[model samples]
Structure formats: structure tokens, C-alpha cells
Target: MLKRVIQQFQLDVLATSEVEDSHSSTVYKCTLSNGENVYLKIPFTKLKYQRELEAYEILKGKVSIPEMINYWSGDEECPGAFLLSELKGKPLTSAAKPTTAFQVGVLHAKMHSTQPPSEQVLNGMKNEFPNWSHFIDQQFYSFAEDAKYILDERLYQKAIEKFERMKQQLPLSDGPSFIHMDFRPANIIVDNEQVSGVIDFESVRFGSTEVDFSKLYRDFLSYDSSLYSAYQRGYNSIRPLIDLEKVLPFYRFTDAFNSIGWCKRRGNQEHALFLEENLARLKKWLL
Candidate 1:
């Protein structure tokens, strides 16, 4: 089905679109007859495929995002939807920069400015996951028991307790906006020191604008203070100041829980370790 679709699209050479490490889908890169580069993503499930396609359509041309050219439904032979989009530059993870952090901050600010079609669409886009306590009790702790040896139970329990207490004292905001729930460095593309494009809209949902920045801060700024400062400068250039102290704990907790899930599914020891370390850090922050 993919081959036929590529042929129908008049593609010349199918570049390496082999599966990446994502647990979701099989992604491919194809070059068309006119030297146009395109990415084909086929998810493991029908729901995910539909969600990603909807997200791509919603996000197309709103910000610096790759253009979706076509979508193909799967028959018994294909078994999944096919997403075709123009291949853009490298992700920010590969193209490190002193300004990458700031670029992301600004990008996110712009993304939040675009209003979705309805409040329902906006609500659907928000991270629907519960707060840290529920996430730990239902998700992380269960996973830790399943992967006992890989996790630090004491630290996990401490972090969970801390999160529950901190959640009450944390500041609350009712100003909801479009959030790229997985706004991390790897999903951002850069060229000539500018963000050429943003990719991976699967996690695109409506929620607290801060939810989007959380992943960015955890993935990039936590490693380098200078980058965090630079990112703030860029972000503040567009929007006003954001209270990092209020948001950092939530961001760390979210990232830690996500990392734990990743390690459990993929059996990645490094990710598990990172999860533990982040959990400990969150605990200290809450304390």
C-alpha cells in the first residue's frame, strides 16, 4: 500500500523512512519526482493515526510546521493511515545551539496565540493526564513494581508525596491555550540558526500553555542554565514574564513520569536512571 501510494504520488527515490525509536508508528522518508522530500508516518493503531492527521491539519501553516501533502487510508493490505509531508531540516536535538532554547520559547509563545476552532478542540489538546500524585500512584508506581530492579522505590515514593503536597500550594491559572504536549528539543528543526520547522504533532492538545514549555524546559534548559536564561529572554520578548519557580516542579515531575514509562516499554536503562535522578530533583525542589 505504501509503495503504491508513493508511486501514485510520483515519488522517485524512497529515502530511509525506517522506523525510529518511537513506540507509536513506522515513519518513512520519501523523495518525490520533483526533488521534493516527504515523510510518511503510519501508526500502529487507527486512533493514533487519525489524531496525528487531525493535529497536522490544525497546525499546518499556523506556525513553522511541515506541510501535510496527503493522507491515505489503509485497507486490509495497508492496515494503517499514511501521512505525507514535506521533509524539513534536522531536529534541534541534533543541531545544538546557544539560541535553540530561546527559539523554542518564542515558537511556543506564537503557537499559543493561534485560537483553535472551538473550546472543545482546545480542551481536547490539553494534556489530559492527572496531576503528579495520581500519575505516580496509578502510572509510575505500577510501572516501578513491574520493573522493580530498574527503579528506586524510595525516591519514587518520596517524589509522589512531595508532589501531592506541592500541588495544593502551587499557583493556578485559568488561561488555557494550545499546547504542543510533547514540545521537546527533538521535535524542533533548525536551519541557519533559525527554527525551520516543528515536527511531531501527535501530542498536540489544548491545555495550560505551561504544559508545552515544561517539556522544553526539562529537555533543554535543565541541562544548561545559560540556555534557560537565553530561552527566557526570547520567550519574554514575545510574551511577558513567566514564573519558572511555579512551573519547574510540575515540569520535572511530568518528565520523570514520562521517562519511567519510556524505560519500561523500551527497556532503556539510561532513561530509567534519568527518571530516577529527575524524581530526586523534583523531591528536593518540592521540599
Candidate 2:
């Protein structure tokens, strides 16, 4: 498949190595004959491919994301692929300084403030939900439904009860803004203690900016109080930060529930740890 893509797109002679193969896509780091590096991404499904392409178009100029270099729309038998300019940085890690966390917040704030999609852009979006609240409702219920058989019977019922409570308590969404549904440390890039870029847009959608913070808080910001403070400062610099006390718990619970569902559906051995982690979280919240 890689060779076919290279020949069809006439990518320059290069060396390549697999970078990540998530449920959504497989990515490769390709070193060009001239030593320049780029990313080649092949989404596992047509829907995922289309989502990322649409997101890139919508997010351009407003966010620091990978630049699209080349693309091939796939046919029924083959999934298509695209090339992106290599971002220079490692994925954001716990070791990153508070400065990097601040930049991460700045990135989210900028994304949230992005202009609503133009009518023409909306026409092209196949995945836009009616509103942020609708999207969250769908996500929460969908994950809960999938988790029914996978979770312990008593635990699953308890989770459903908690889900209902959260469903009722969730606040009004802030905007019809661009949101990276998977915004977390691994999707953010850090260079010299500064956030340099964000990647992985296959889950991007038009939703409440508040929904985007759940995963970031679960995986990054919640780990350090000082870092969280810095992040709030940066976000407030651009736009007012959401009242985390009111929203974070609801979103975080849903996020963890979604992780369990994802792991259950994918059924990868590697997902065992994630499954256990979310199970622990759910137990802590519900039991």
C-alpha cells in the first residue's frame, strides 16, 4: 500500500518509518531524498479521511497545524492518503514546562474563537452536528450503550444512572466552534518548552469549545495545579476560560466512559491498560 501510494502520488524518493497506527489512521514519517521530513497519513475509513481533510481546511490560518502538502482521494477498494509538512517537535509530555501548557491553552482558545464556518464550508461538512449539546448527548449515550455488555452489570447500571445525572446537569454549550475532540498531550507538539503544533484531526468537529477541554484535562492539565493555573491564564488572555468547576466533572466522566467503549469495540491487547484505567475512573466516580 505504501509503495502504491508513493508511485501514484509520485512522492520523492525517501526513507520512511511507521509513526502511529491508531484506530482511525496509520501515519508514517517520511524523510525526503533532500532530507526534509513529512507525514503520510492513511485513514482506515473514508469517513475519518474526509473528517481530517475538512478539519484542515477549516482550521488553516487559525491554528498551528500540519500543512497539507499532497493528497489522494481513495476509491472503494482503497483508503486514500495525504501528506503533511512535518511539524518540528515531540509530542507534549508530562515533563514539559508550564510554558508549554500555557501555549496548549492558547491553542485551544484560538481554535474556539475561530470564525464559524461559512455557508459554503458548512455545505461541505458531512459531520457537523446541530449543536454542541446535541453532539455531547449523542456521544454520552452512544458510549453508554456500547459499554453495557462490557462492564460489570451492577457497575454498568450505576454508570448509566450517573450518566443521566450528568446529562441533566451539563451547561449550555459555548459555541458552534472548531473543536479537536481528541485534544490531549499526545496530539499536541512541544518544542523547546513551547507548544509548536497540534495534530490528529480525524475527530475534529463543530461543537462546544467546552467539550474539547475534557480530554486535555484528563490527560494533561489535571496532573499539575501550577500548570493548570498557567493554562487558565493563557486561555483567559485570548478568551474567558470556562468555569471548570461546573463543567469539568461532567465532561471528564463522559470522556472516561467513551474510552471504555472505544477499547471494547477495538479489542486490542494494547487497550487493556486504557480499559482498566477508565474502569477505575468510572468506579471512583460512581461507586
Best by lDDT: 2
Lowest-scoring 10 consecutive residues by lDDT in candidate 2?
A: 120-129
Q: List candidate 1 stretches off by more than 4 Å.
A: 1-10, 19-21, 76-79, 94-100, 119-153, 268-287
Question: 21-120, model 2: which lDDT tens digit per residue?
Answer: 3557888888888888988889887778888888788888989999998889987766789989978888887776788778888998998887556664
In candidate 2, stretches whose alpha carbon ends up further than 4 angstroms from where it belongs are: 123-129
User: Model 1's lDDT to the true fold?
Assistant: 0.63
Q: Estimate each model's TM-score.
A: 0.78, 0.94
Candidate 1 accuracy as TM-score: 0.78
Full-model lDDT for every candidate = 0.63, 0.80
Writing each residue's lDDT as its tens digit, candidate 1 over 21-114 gives 4556777777655776677777766666666776766666777787767677666666455546653566676336668667877787777765
Question: What is the RMSD of candidate 1?
Answer: 4.1
